[model samples]
Structure formats: C-alpha cells, structure tokens
Target: MRTNYEAHDIPYRRKKAAGWPGWNSAEEVHDCIQTLNGLLEPLEVASTADVCEIGCGAGNLTDTLADRGWSVTGVDVSNVAIHWARERCRQQNVTFLRGNICERELFAPASFDLIIDGLCLHCIIGEDRDRVISNLSYWLKPGGRIVVFTMCGEPKGKDRAGYDPKSRCAFSGDIAVRYFAKAEEIIDEFRKESLQCTFQQVVDPPNEQASLRALFEKPR
Candidate 1:
C-alpha cells in the first residue's frame, strides 16, 4: 500500500536524527505507557506475557513493556526505526523486525498474547486496513488481546485532514491517514468479527490530542 509521506525522506531523516525516541515527547510517551497499563489491568496476565507492538516507532512503548517484564516483539516498516529500536532496547526478550503488516507470513500465527497498534493503525488506508485487521486477528492466540490507539472518527470511512507539524505535512499527505472508528465503532466492528472489544478515551496531558483506546480479544 502507498503511504502519504515520502517513505525514504522524512522517515529516514527522523530515524537518523533521534531514532524513534524523538517521535513524541517524554510526557506523551508517559501517557501512552499509562494507557496501556490501564488496559492490561483486567487481563491479570503475567508481566512475562508475550507482546507484539506494530508500528513501534522508536520502541518507546516496546521499552516500556519490557520494563514491565513483558517479552516484546516490535515491528515497523522503517528500517531505521527497527534498527533504532533494537539498539535502544538491548533486552534479551525484546525483538525488533522491519516488515509490512499486510503480509502475515513474516510472523507465525497465534504467536502473541497481546498486539499493540500505538497509533499505527491510523496510517493504513482502504482495503489494506481490512487485510491488516484480518491478519492481526489471525496471528493472535485464542483469548489474546489487541490494544490500539488512534485519532477518533467513524469506522470504515475517510479520515480527517490537518497539518502535523512533527511530520511537516498534512495528515499522511495526499491520501490522508484512515481513521477507521471511534470507541463505539470499534466495539461494533469487533463484535461483528466475533472479537470482544472494550473501548476508552485517553486525553493527553493538559488535554492535547484525544486518542481512542480499544482493547480487543480473540475468542477462546
């Protein structure tokens, strides 16, 4: 699938400059960590649970998960991001791979207990989104959880457009990033797929960006 940003340019510059650590502020990172922690609460799973983080930018969330004692596998399309994550994490249990989400062969099915999107899902567009969801569900173990955070909007429709100073471009550029669904929409979609979904809203510190958090479970 074609992405809005110049795959080589900004991703390369951003990767080299500060790696994935520069993607968001320390405060923003803290909020994401807290949000994931909250979602994992009811699961009551061991901290050693196997976790996979898709689009794990600089590995910030992956690092956080590792610190919490989870075995994490972080995947990203950018080679720079993967390299940065591998170098920064340096933990035996944390693995980083560069790959496309549309292809499920990269990782074994039913491999992870928890799969995290961390704002990456918004980047996928059109039929690619459906393929991604299908692959993710297929790869998850029964009763496994998938946690996602993204900009709020209706499910399966056009995304809202605006400039992002960080990326120095309008949302995903020409095509714009797809905002699949809001909290309610996410729940509905999961239900239709026979996956249980729990939704929540997370406001960044001082109420900056409003991100919708959804926790989905594969039926046992």
Candidate 2:
C-alpha cells in the first residue's frame, strides 16, 4: 500500500492536474468541507480547534481548515505526498507529517479535537481497517468527532468490474487496492470503539461510483 501510494504521489506532484482517482477536479473536496461545516455547528467545535487529517494527500482540505484559523495536522504514508502537502499549505497553523495510520505511535492518545479520514480509510484493507479506526478514536479528545469520506456499498461501472465481493476490495488487475465496505458495517465498527454516529449519508450516483460520508462523535 505504501509503495503504491508513493508511486501515485510522484506524478501528482509533478503535474498537479490529475485530481484524484475517482474524481474529476483537484478541488473536488467540497463534500468533505461541507460535511465538516455541518458538524461544527452541532458539535460546537472551537475556532482554533486542533484537527488531524489522515491521508491528507497534497493537503487540499487541510489548507482550507488552516485558513479558517484551525490548527491542522496532515498525515500521509507517502513522503512525496507529504512534501507536496507541506508546500501547498505553508501556513504555520498547518503541519504535514508522513506516517501510516496503522502505527499506534503516529500520534499521542487524545491528540486531536477532531480527525478527518480524508477519503483514505477505504484504501486500507483487512484487520488494518479496525486498527485504523481504533487509532482514530484513540487520537481524539473526549468530546472530539471523526469525519469520514469513503467508498461504500457496491461499486458501479468499471469499479464493479474490478470488485471482489468476498474481500470487499476493488482490484487493479490482480492487485487488491480499495475496499468498498457496507455503510452499516462501518458504523458498527465505530460503535465497537464507542464512537456514536451523529450523521450519515451515502451518495450513490447513477452509473457512477458510490461513497459514504459520515460523522462520529466521542462522548465527553
């Protein structure tokens, strides 16, 4: 997974034109931004809230949070991605670190006021998904929230062609790359970590790909 992401980041850094794999625009982070905004009101997020964005590729959304006066920490396994992220968002309030989310020591327990999955969780497969969720919960403050953007349910079109139902993974040739978990399954996993699902939305566009956007809150 690490090597695969590192390879993807190099071309992205040089061209900065391909956007993301599934999306068309490089600035297509509006859904994440919008979901986060909705959570702020109900959760009463502080103006200078400390946020951590997991797999913050090129720091697109991380930069926006910093612009809002929030302190942001962006983490990605790809060093190339982290380097580009640091360059893209040079604000003092934003810091980019290269690290894998499955590592327990990537961040101290209760390190962030909120954690954004940044559409990275689905890229993780197997028991690692559980480990990553546990880490996300551990990293959050008592009353913190986690916002997730991920591929969920069934795939469509080309994605469906590559889908492996047994593992819930989408493959590129013989290599398994992405997981498309059921929304209920994901919420159940969060529940196991004692995080409550405050908001959930599944977007399955016609003949296109499907995605899940959700907000989970930790009890105070």
Question: How well does each candidate superpose onto the true structure, as a TM-score?
Answer: 0.80, 0.87
Poorly placed runs, candidate 1 (over 4 Å): 1-9, 15-20, 154-173, 178-180, 202-207
TM value for model 1: 0.80
What are the RMSD figures for all models against the true structure? 4.9, 2.9
Over the stretch 1-220, how does candidate 1's per-residue lDDT look in tens digits? Answer: 3354226336545546753353566777897788778876777667768889988877888987888788888888877677677777888888898888878797898998999888887667556667788888888999898887876543222223454434322345464544444456555655766778755564433334456777888999
Stretches of candidate 2 exceeding 4 Å from the true structure? 1-24, 30-32, 35-41
Give RMSD (Å) of candidate 2 vs. truth: 2.9
Candidate 2 has its poorest 10 consecutive residues by lDDT at 18-27
lDDT: worst 10-residue window of model 1? 152-161
In candidate 2, what are the lDDT values of residues 51-103, reduced to their tens digit? 99898887877877788788889998877777778766789988889998989
Report, for every candidate in turn, its global Cα lDDT versus the true structure.
0.71, 0.79
Which pairs clash inside model 2? Answer: none
